[model samples]
Target chain A: MKRIVQILDSYSYGDGMGNHAGALLNALKARGVDTQIYAKYVDPRLSHMGKNVAEYVPSQEDVILYHLGAGSELNRKVTEYPGRLIINYHNITPPEFFADYNPALEANCRAGYEDVKFLADKVEMAISVSAYNSSELARMGYTCPLHQAPIVMDFSDYTKAPDAATVEKYSDGVSNIVFVGRICPNKKHEDLMLDFYYYTKYFNPNSRLILVGNYRGFEGYYLKLKKYAKKLGLTNVVFTGHIKFSQILAYYHTADLFLCESEHEGFCIPLVEAMHFGVPIVAYDSSAIGETLGTGGVLLREKNPRLTASVMDQILRDESLRKTILEQQKENLKRFDSKAVADRYMEFLLGD
Target chain B: MNYETYAPVLEKAKAALAKKNIPETAVSFCDVRMPAWMGKAFWFVSGVKRKMKRRLGK
Candidate 1:
């Protein structure tokens, strides 16, 4: 009998990678596959979900699927396993983005490339979350079989009722423009702030921009953004730094527009969430944004704050246009139907 | 709808841009670096933790 094990550095609580890993674990188990999660740092709350990698005993028939995103000692250990090994490559951010913001992560990401490139020849198969990441793997010389699948997610979780208090507090009828992502340099938070500035200065004064994400490792960058917002003399810009899942649900529930200006994304999951909530999206066309959006929202060819603000305004004021975008988003979202994605992942995971 | 359909909206935005004052949007970060000794100490502690975990069979 063979077993499949998913290995990662950290199995966190609610971040994109953690959620995808957790969902993939359950999806595999549901299909009666003997699957387990092994990680270096397991969140205390999710300790039952996985065990420490130090205790992961290797078997000759075991298929090890290593999730590679950052530089970690675990990345080196997985290469020594004498069995079928797969590299599930989640794109790593370029180290240049973090040179000034975080020295530790910058070093980790720099070494991460070396780690990834070193494993290129060791793995029997490589899988990525998007075509963008697949192309990146190819560029890095991953010649083994390569497959692309959206991160496994149970979208039904989004249907859970948002916190009532949160929804009520933020649903004061004022327009709310929202962007949900980690407060990292690559996310281009300043660009979102500028669009909000132009929108408020010219179009609607009753609007507020909500940025919801954790800024623990990148405190310097977070502080700089706050200082920059003050320098712009911007008002009504809310930074909800790492809130509860229900509160995130509430924010998405109250959002009138989902705007993203991220320069790089393995696959922007928030775009799909915004579509799930029927919030029209306006994102810059870059990296995997276009592929993930799939005609679901308005894609800007360039990062022009004034133009983005106008497009946002038009989508907000023109009821017909907003309806059309929402309809397209609903159709586009079907591509991520949980069962379809899970089956696709199974084919890749269980294939020859 | 294709991106070109938003051309009129872009034109409107361009017209509006000509009338309003735009702020400089470039951002700069604070120069924050940890001393080499502290970094080495942190790495030493992490390596110890990994060794301890392995020894404890966890």
Candidate 2:
């Protein structure tokens, strides 16, 4: 019997890709598949979840699933290995998004695209998390077998008790608007602030926008957004820069509405997260937001600030409407149920 | 569920916008620059660490 193994460039706790890989590993193990995860870079916190990719000696019959997100030497070296190779294509950001922010990131993204193209014909199959990404694989000339599945998410993780201090701090009867994602250029945090400016100024003065994510490498963009908020005189806008998972859950718990104006997303995990938490979503329709959000919440066709604010105001003020949206989001979340998704992965990979 | 459902609400918002007078604030795009002070040291160290990690294939 051939063993199944997963490989990626980096594995860090709280990262969406790393979490997805971890969940997939657990799911495979539950099905009794002999598996392990190998990563070129493993965060010290998640050291147990992955082994050094260099230590992974591949045998001829083993099936290797390469989780491709960025450009790395690991991506290139894996092509020479003797095994059944498959590409788990997590769409990479276009280098242009980083061209004005970080040159190194721009180069990595450019190289990521090059690596994808390089492995196009080498892999036996390509699995993408969204149709938008699948189209990119097709455009990249992947003639091999292609399948689409939602990223494996362990929704039960949200059910864990959140930080008591976080819940006590933010749950003060004030309306809280939340968006959770890394503070990266592609996320378009400025658009979020603009819409939020309209919301707080005209709709409700007691509201605050809570942006919970890490801003380590993207501090320049973070600083610009902070300055922009100050110039607009937007008060009560909070930037919780990379806190604990419990603290994140607390934000979700206290949130009244989840608003996302991100311009690009491979598959917006936060939207599903908002659904799991029963927070109504109001996201701009771009990339995979529509498909991921489904009929769970309202989708904006464009980023008209006044219009966006109006939708948020309506959702917040109308209890019945809020209830209806939450119900729909709950229904939509059934698609991402951990067991169902794991079963789907098994079928997609093993042809059951 | 659709845009038409919010037509009445949006119309009211548009009216409120016309009556309320506030100067439009602009938040222009500014390119990111390198960090300063201790931040600069942290950035340099992380950059070097990433490069070393890639080279070591670990």
Candidate 3:
């Protein structure tokens, strides 16, 4: 049997990346390949690097698969190992997108890109999560064989009865708008809040904005956002810090509109989740948002708060347009299910 | 037991050790020159300090 090992800094089964990795591993195993995930950590949060480093040397029979290029320990192993290396490029943000765009972060990300580029050259093959990321690798001069492996979402739960009571509880008799993912600078929660503040003021005063994710890592940015919301008199906004995956769908179902103004993404999994729930999305046309949203959702011009708010207002006010989007979302969402994504990934990994 | 199952568990243990607040000199005293299994652990702990320092903007 062919042996395959996946290397990651962290592996949370509840996370989008973790689910993607887990599904791929299962698919590989189903094809009669002996596959195991070798990571530093295996929880719902944080990267899984430190946990597995002590005993993870590759054997002659193993093909090592590296996920994400952020950790030095993994980098060192890749440099020392002489096995077949296959890297799955998730989200590799250019240094210029960082807070201060500091030279240090730039240099570090550049070094990461160099390591990934080197591994890409030596590896049997490389797979990116989106075409946007593949183009990013190509621009950085990585000439290895590349293919897109979109993230997967299992939407069987959405077909169940709509928990109207649970949805109404979160909705609070107003239009519920939700923004998922980490409350970090890159996710652009602050920009979304600013737009949301204005969106409620002029368009619908009863609408509530919900920001969900961990706040510990981005305290400074999170504080700034809270202060901005206070200054704008948008106290009705809710900040839900880290929710369970099962509860996430309730929020998606309850939400009248979903907004993603992120500056970068490998593949916005939340957008896919929202689409699966038939929620209309108004996202900035950048990175993988355009590719994921396709023609089913509204695309905002730039990341301007006014433009985003304007688009949100338009979506909320029009009932016919909202119904049309929901109908289209139901149709477009089939392309991102886990089985389809897993099949594509298996074909890439096993097909000659 | 196949090496695949044991490899990840061993690596995770090394990574956990690296995150501890132990002194560098004391950490260095640990044997890092065992067979492939133990050698992997030592390399992980020794390199973690360097990795943390770099991420700290040091």
Candidate 4:
């Protein structure tokens, strides 16, 4: 049996990356490949045993699959290991994303760039999560054998709930707009909140906005956002904080409209989830959002909250339009289904 | 120094120092570019002072 070892920095319980890794491992196993996952930290919920590479010895038969993060020491070991190295570049943030254009982030990104260059020069192959990310690798001067295999989501556990509790909780006889993902500056949670507030005020007073996900390395920014919401007198805006995978589906199912204003993304998984639940989306026309949304969701050409509000207003005011978008989304989402993505990934991995 | 090779690191170091509120000139003088003799003398004096303080327990 072919042995594969996948390495990552951290695998939080029920995160997008963790879920994708789990599904990919299962698919590989189904193909009769023996797979083991190694990470600095693994979610306790996952069955795969975690091993700290610094303390553990890797077996000779193992093929190393690495997700190269910012300043990973594992880059050194990849050269030492006598196996095929496949690096999956998730999202390499450009220097502009930082608040003050943090140099540390830039240095780390440069290190990642060098690692990719080294891997491209020496390793077997490299994979990126999106065409945008692949282009980023090219920009970094990596001319390796690159393939675009976007992350896959498993919707088996995301069946629509029977109860209307989520709808009543968020909507309350109003339009409920939901935004999911980490509460960071790049995710633009504050912009979405401001737009939602204006959207509710000028367009639909009964509308409510729900923001989900945890604040990671952006607590001060999140606090500032909360203050901004309060300053705007947004009583209808609700911050659900961090939620579990099951709870996420509940929100997605109940939301009248899903909004994403992320300035960067490798592949927007929540956008796919929203479509799976037949939720119409309004998102910024940037990064992989436009690629993923295609014709299924409305895109804002500019980053103005009033313009975003106007777009949301249009979606809310027109029922037939919303239904049409949702129907198109259902069809558009099939291209990103786990089976199709998995097949493409395997084909790329095995070079078929 | 070639800007392509050294510019990025120097720029990053400058930014890091600025974040800490240390004067760029002072950091460059003390941290990045100090004469070998001056660095050795400073280290030797500091080492001797640390030893004396520890011995005296003061």
Candidate 5:
């Protein structure tokens, strides 16, 4: 029997890439193919998740699926390895996005961009989570066949009720606007606050902006966003640094709107999660976001807080519109169902 | 959550930005002493940047 091997730069708890990798491992195993996950670094918390890359031995029958996102040094070997290669491109933040703020990540991102070009010849098939990223490979001059799929999400965990404590804490009559993603440069944290400012100034004063993501290395940008919000005279803006999934679901449970002002996203998983939780979304159509949304939520070309505020008010006050958005979002959520996506991936993994 | 704390600090940041434009540079670092996982790509990027800089100087 052939083995399905996975490679990633790093794995951590609650990471989107790690989630996809973990889910993919299970999918391959269910098909009775042996699977092994190798990573440059694994979070101590998820020690059993994957082993060090040094321990990974490439066999002729082994198909290695490499998840590319961050600027990790371990990826070069993924191409040099003598086996079938699958390039799973999770779009990297353009290095320019971090040029002004974070030099280290900017360098890493530049390397990631450069690394993809070298894979043009080695990869058997390149799969992008979104078509926008597929087009990028085309532009890079990769001649290999390419495929696209949304991130495989386990909605079972989402359907279960969120933590009641989190739900009750924020359920106190305040309209909560939530964005779940890392506090990174491209997320446009400043822009989210601008929209929040307009939403509160015109629509509802008791509203809150809840950001749920870890801001460990992004402390500078995070602090900058905090100061920018202060400059705008906005309050009720809470950055929940990092919290458990149940708590995240609680924020979603109490959230009135799921809003994204991210300037770049290969595919935003949080938007789908919000839809699963029945929160209506209003997102800026950046890169593959519109395609990811796929008739689920309102897509805006530009960030106009005033107009977005009006849309939120319209969605909230008009029962018909609210119901319509949620209904469409629910209909759209079927595309990302774990079993369905895993089946699609099986075809490629099995070379059927 | 205090909205006021950001105002004065942001003004200072704006003032700093007004002084000079930021430079554009390629990412490059390669040393064996650094974590073994840094791999050859880290130094490869550095080599490419050096060549570009040398060519531009000519």
Candidate 6:
């Protein structure tokens, strides 16, 4: 059997990209390939699942799959590994996005650009999660065998019934509009507020706009959002900061729509999740989001709160229209299904 | 007046992250909390070894 090892910069328990890597590990093991994960950082409790990058030993016959989304020593090590290297390219957010607020982030992102290019010539083959990301590698002059596959999605969690307490907490009769993302600058929470303001004023006054995400690192931005919401004189707009998984499911079930205004997204897992939960997605047509939704969900090229509200009104009131969008969503979801995506992944990783 | 006119929360996070003592090699976008010197040392050695390997062509 061929041996394959995947390396990443870090692994978080519940993160999208991390989960993608984890799913690959499980899929590879199921295929009977000797596979393991190595990372620069890992949760202590989950140490058995992976090892530190520094501890990894290279093998000439072994294929190493590296997930590249940030700058790290792992880049230098993987570049020098002198073995079969396949890079799972996830686009690095442009450095300019963080220019005003954090120079360190700017520097790190800049490093990611340099590292990706520096290691490009070393890769035997390249796979990106999206065609948009593949195009980026092409622009960087990577002349290797390149293919695109959506990340393997685990839909099991979404299928399970959510926590009763959480479902009860959100069972209020209010119409809910939800967006799940980290409380960060790139997500454009301010725009969410603008849309919510118009959504409530014009379409459904009984509705509540619920923003569900972790507010740990970006408390400053979190505070600004609160101040902005208050400034808008908006009522019933809830920022449910860092809640439990059951709570998240409750939000998804209670939500009538999933709205996003993210300026940049590599794969936008939330868009797919919203589709999975039967929540119709309305998103800005930028980055990989348009590619992700295809023709299933609504894509707005521009953000107009008044017009956005009208569109939401149309979807909510028109049961047929909602059903049509949901049907298309189910069609698009077939692309990201675990079995199909995993088979594609194995094909790329093992194919000659 | 609208989202266009309002200052973004991302900027706030960015500014705050820039102030923290994080090494550039941090894996996460802005929530890096590792000691400064350790991250620096790892990169420093990695860079040196990379150059040496290239020179040796091994």
Best by lDDT: 1
Q: Return the DockQ of model 5.
A: 0.02
> Tens digit of lDDT per residue, candidate 5, span A226-338?
76666667778999976778888888889899999898999999988988889999888788888888778877766656566666666767787778788888988888888
Better of 4 and 5 by lDDT: 5
**Residue-wise C-alpha lDDT for candidate 2, range A217-239, written one tens digit per residue:** 77667777887888778888999
Candidate 5 stretches greater than 4 Å from native: A159-161, B1-58
| Residue-by-residue lDDT tens digits, candidate 3, A1-352 | 5577777866765667677677677667667877777667767343332235456766766677678745345764664666667678886666565543234445676667667665655666678888898887787676878888787554554566555666668866788989888776678776777777657765678889988676543444555566667666678788876555556667877888899889888788888888877788877878887777776677654555554565576567768767867776777677777777878876766565
Chain A TM value for model 2: 0.98
Residue B7 Cα positional deviation in candidate 4, in Å, after optimal superposition: 45
**Interface C-alpha root-mean-square deviation of candidate 4:** 22.0
Each model's TM-score for chain A is 0.98, 0.98, 0.87, 0.90, 0.97, 0.96
What are the per-residue Cα lDDT tens digits for candidate 1 across A10-120? 999987888888998889899999999999999988888899988999987888889988999988889888778998888899999988667889999999999989988
Prediction 3 global C-alpha lDDT: 0.67
Instruction: Rank the candidate models, highest TM-score first.
Output: 2, 1, 5, 6, 4, 3
- Residue pairs in candidate 4 whose N, alpha carbon or C atoms collide under 3 angstroms: none
What DockQ class does candidate 3 belong to? incorrect
Better of 2 and 4 by lDDT: 2
CAPRI grade, predicted model 4: incorrect
* Candidate 2 off by > 4 Å: B1-23, B26-58
Scanning candidate 2 chain A in windows of ten residues, the lowest lDDT window is: A343-352
Model 6 residue runs over 4 Å out of place are B1-58
Between candidates 2 and 3, name the one with more favorable DockQ: 2
Q: What TM-score, computed on C-alpha atoms, does each candidate reach?
A: 0.89, 0.90, 0.76, 0.79, 0.84, 0.84
Candidate 4 lDDT tens digits, A181-265: 8776678776787677667766688888889787544444555666677666778887876555656777876788999989988
